[model samples]
Target: MNEQLIHSKITSMEIDVLRAVKQRTLEKFTEGPSVERARLFFLLLPYFDGKHWSGEIEASAKTVSIVYAALHAHDQVKENASATKKQQLTVLAGDFYSGIYYQMLANLNNITMIQRLATAIIKVSEKKASFHDGLDRTTAELDRSVQQIETELLATFYNFYGFDHYTPLATLMLSYIRYKDELECLQGGSETRIIRSLNETLQHPLHTERWLLEKLDNLHDQISLTINSYNFNYDLKNFMLHQITPHQHRAEQLTREG
Candidate 1:
């Protein structure tokens, strides 16, 4: 399929997801559940790539997205601070999305998937907690934690549906996207849990920036190599590179600056 058509299909799935979890009070008070487009693209990648897709598989994909939204909502809840009404509503929204995902899987009679997702959620929770647990982790360990946190649920979905081949690409792209966000947060004079941990580990903001730049360059190279390994058509590959992950090498930037 062409890129536009692929994007259109992804947008359709996104709308369906948003409708599935929309709540009046949450819409009014909280930011509501985040249904990210890039994530939706990855969740539906198999379908996009002409894998055997059923309605059941589509439903499972939606539930996976809902799970991510639920976790993202909970992540927005402030720690060690008094809860405001919005904060309370945000918590409720997270719980509400969690229930929606459970009910969705239950309706589909996907008990196996539910069990698998529960394990993935536990792993993701543990990884998130590691950032604040005051335990010293090596950069490799920290990268693994971040990878699990970002892609575990999606990886679960991929594994369940025999699309595990996509896991490596998904992990790299998601991690690159995450580090891109962290780099932006740092440049914007804001701090996040990941940034704080990274700063503590790397020993300075400058080091963190350098690490992020090098990581992005590495991931982009991997993505270029991995994309060629797949049997994707021109439009699909082009869309993934140009739309999902446009990269500019840091070394090239430095050379031009010099």
Candidate 2:
């Protein structure tokens, strides 16, 4: 697909997903879902590439976005120490979005994808919980968890639809984005679970910063190699490199400045 077609499709999916999860009270109180445009791009990549796509598949893709929105809603809930009105509603917003995903799938009669997504959610939740378990995990071990938290849902969707070739690229790109956000949070002094977990694992904020910078560099390289290995069209590859994954050297410059 050309850049316009790809971008248009992604924007359409974003609009559909946002409309799918809208709620007046939740919108009023809680931070809305953190549906990254990059993530949505990857979710719709198969369709963009003209894979085994159908309306059912496109509808399923929307539900996958809904699932991501559902999970991200819970991530907005503040720590138990501060249960404000927004925080209370944040939890319910997650549940409400989750229910919407289930109902959406049930209406499609897509029992198989529902089961697969449920399994993915379980694994993602387990990895997320490990952050709170007070385990002295090595940086590698912790990163694996973070990678799962970043990629499991998308991986599940890709695998279900025979788009497994995109898994490595997806994992690398998604983790890169997650680390990019974490790096930004560290610089901004924002408190987040990923930041706390990275601090605990790395033993210092500086070390966490260094680790994230290095990881981003490594992921960017891997993403380049993985994308090159695939025979994607010029437009797809260009959009991915220029639009999705950051330039690692530039990212390092910014991180060092911070």
Candidate 3:
């Protein structure tokens, strides 16, 4: 959120991590370079809360965001049989980011957060794998996986800093964001593992659309309920609701028409 502060912290550590991961061979072979901002904000949340902030903590957080970028990069991989250069790099991106996170934590002797984040990654991976598993999951089961994938890393960081108060709000909002994107994908005729699973489960794209609409409605209700449960101040809550999950009248119209 604070660009100067986060950029100052992120630029210093990101440069070092990039330097360490640099292999003249790999650099030449790679497709793109850099991290992302949404992830940076979640990583810096504890710092914003005035937690036990430090260079080591900030560096660790960057690696965590890098890890998310890695996974996210891979999630872009096409289901096509012929993988492109970008898709190939995506697979390595997640692996490379993971190695950097481990190395950074190891250098700092922050073995505990390493273990915590590793466990979080395992949960995230399993949930991600569920979408590709061809398993017949109910809407509840699918929703649970989505929640874990969105919140596991942030939840680990929150639990580490005794900032568990943010978990409920983060979980709700992130899940909302994810489902919102999923709905857009549905409307655009794009295929995602979740959309495919829903299609298979529902037996038609129309049913998939209905399923997604209902799912989003439920997630929005949950978000509202969970946000109210948090002790966050008015401004923070307003920012999340208005900025993050601003109500889309068009989306409501589509849902109603469906």
Candidate 4:
């Protein structure tokens, strides 16, 4: 599929996921969901490739997206002394989305997927908690945790439906997108948990930034090679290059100007 079609499909799935989990009070008070476009693109990638897509599969995909949003909401909670209203509601929002995902899967009689995803969530939460528990991790250990934090859910979904072929590319691309944003946050001095943890792990913010930039470059090369290794068409490859993984946001900016 072309990028336009892929984007439209993802937007529609996103709207459905949002509506399924929407609550008026949460919408009025909280920072809504953090559904990233990159995750959605990977969730819909098998379908975009004209694979074994059905309404049930699409519903399952949406549930995975909701699960991502749910976990992402809780990750926003700071480590210490945050009793703010937003913090309180953010906790509830995460729980609420978790429940919605369970119920959605139950409705489809997908108890197996629910079980698998629950396991994935457990692994993810353990890695997330490792940060706060003050476990002294080396840079390599931290990188492993970050990969699970970013790709476990999507990998579970793909593995469930024989779409596991895309796992490597999806993991690399999504992790790249995350570090890209983390680099921006470092430059902006935002001090997210990932940044703070990485700074401590790397012993300096500048080292963390350099590590991130190097990882992004390495992942870009891996993604380029992996995408070509697949039998995807030119349009899909173009979308992966220009839309999914590029040299940097600078490449995207120059493309727009040209």
Candidate 5:
């Protein structure tokens, strides 16, 4: 099948995912369902490239993206103990998304991917917890954990369908995107677990910024190499490259005479 057909199938599944996870309270309080098109495109890339594709496979892929959105919503939850109602619902949003993914997979009878993704989530959570543990972690270890958190769910889906070719590029690109956001949070004077852990190790926020810049540069190089390893067409490769990395941030403007 062609790319358009693959994308259509994935989109249909995504609609179902949103329907499955819809809740009155969540719809009212938390941010609405975040069915990111970029992630859906990547999830369906293997199918789009003329690999072994099926309705069940597409369904599983949609669930995988939902899992990502779920975890991403939780990541937005403030570390503040005095979280407001919206923030509390944001925490439940992740858990609710997790339930939707589980139920969708069960309906598909693809128990194997469910197990695999669950295991991947466990590892991701453990790595996230490590950052909260008051221990200094080396830059390399921190990078690895961030990577696993960024790509493990998608990688689990890919690996299940023998589509491991995209894991390296996805891992590099996703992790780079994550660190970019963290850098913005740091500049905005907010705290992230990774940034907090990095501050502990580096002993200053400036050092944290330096470390993130170096990490983003290195990930860009790695992403370039990993993309070359894939047998994707020029258009597909160009789309992923232009859209994913090397991601650039817009310059901030300030009124000096104010």
Candidate 6:
């Protein structure tokens, strides 16, 4: 599909997801479910590449996104701080979204998928907890945790549907997107847990910045090489490269800064 059409489909899917998990109190107080366009694109990548797809698969994908939103809401809860009403509602919103996902899957009679996604959620939660557990993780180990945290649910969805070929690409692209967000946060003088962990590991924000820049460049290179190995159409390739993961080299960035 063309880029515009691809985007249109993602937006439509986002609307469906929002509709699936809409709640009045959550909508009124907390930030509603954040269905990222990039994630939706990756979830629908198999369909966009002309693989077998059905209404059931689409519903399963929506549930995956809902679960992500649920986890994200919990992630927003403050650490070691008294629970404000917003935080309390955020926790409730997470649970509420979790229930919606389970109910959606049950309605579709996708017991296997529900089980698989539950396992994926367990893995994701474990990796997320590692950030607080002070396990003395190396930077590489932490990177792996980040990768699993970002892609495990989608990976489970893909594996359940026999689209394992997209796993590596999704891992690379999602990790790159995540680090890009972290880099932006660093540059903007905002510290996220990921940034704090990296700073602790690398021993300085400067080192963290350098590492993130190199990581993005490396991921972009891998994406370029990996994209060629797949039989993606020109439009799909273009959309992924230019739209979803447009890259600027560190050198280019420096030159622009100069």
Q: Give me the candidate number with maximum lDDT.
A: 6
lDDT of 6: 0.94
The 0-to-1 C-alpha lDDT of every candidate, in the order given, reads 0.93, 0.87, 0.73, 0.88, 0.80, 0.94
* Per-residue lDDT of model 2, residues 1-258, tens digit only: 899988898888898888888889888887786678998999998887778789898888889888988898887765565877877898899999999999999999999999999999999999999988988888888889999999999999999888999998899898988889889999899867878888987789998888888888888888888899988899999999999985757566977879
Tens digits of lDDT, candidate 5, 5-57: 54576577678778878899999998867877667777878866768988888
Which scores greater on lDDT, model 3 or model 4?
4
After superposition, the stretches of candidate 5 with alpha carbons farther than 4 Å from their true spots are 1-16, 246-258
Candidate 3 least-lDDT 10 residues: 31-40
Model 2 regions more than 4 Å off: 250-258
User: lDDT by residue for model 1 over 1-258, one digit each (tens)?
Assistant: 998899899989999999999899999999988999989999999998999999999999999999999999999999876899999998999899999999999999999999999999999999999999998877888999999999999999999999999999999999989988988899899999998899899999999989988989999999999999999989989999989989889988789879
Please, what are the lDDT tens digits per residue for candidate 3 over residues 157-225?
Answer: 878767788787778778777878888998998878888877777889888877766766776777788
Q: List the residue pairs that clash in candidate 2.
A: none
- The Cα error of candidate 2 at residue 253, in Å, is 0.9
Ten contiguous residues minimizing lDDT sum, candidate 1: 134-143
Model 5 quality (TM-score): 0.86
Query: Which residue pairs clash in candidate 5?
Result: none
Cα error, candidate 6, residue 256 (Å): 1.5
Candidate 2: residue 179 lDDT (0-100): 88
Tens-place lDDT per residue, model 6, 141-188, is: 999999999999999999999999999999999999999999999999
Judged by whole-model lDDT over C-alpha atoms, candidate 3 comes out at 0.73
Clashing pairs in 3: none
Steric clash pairs (candidate 4): none
Which residue pairs does candidate 6 place in steric collision? none
Show model 4 residue runs off by greater than 4 Å. Answer: 249-258
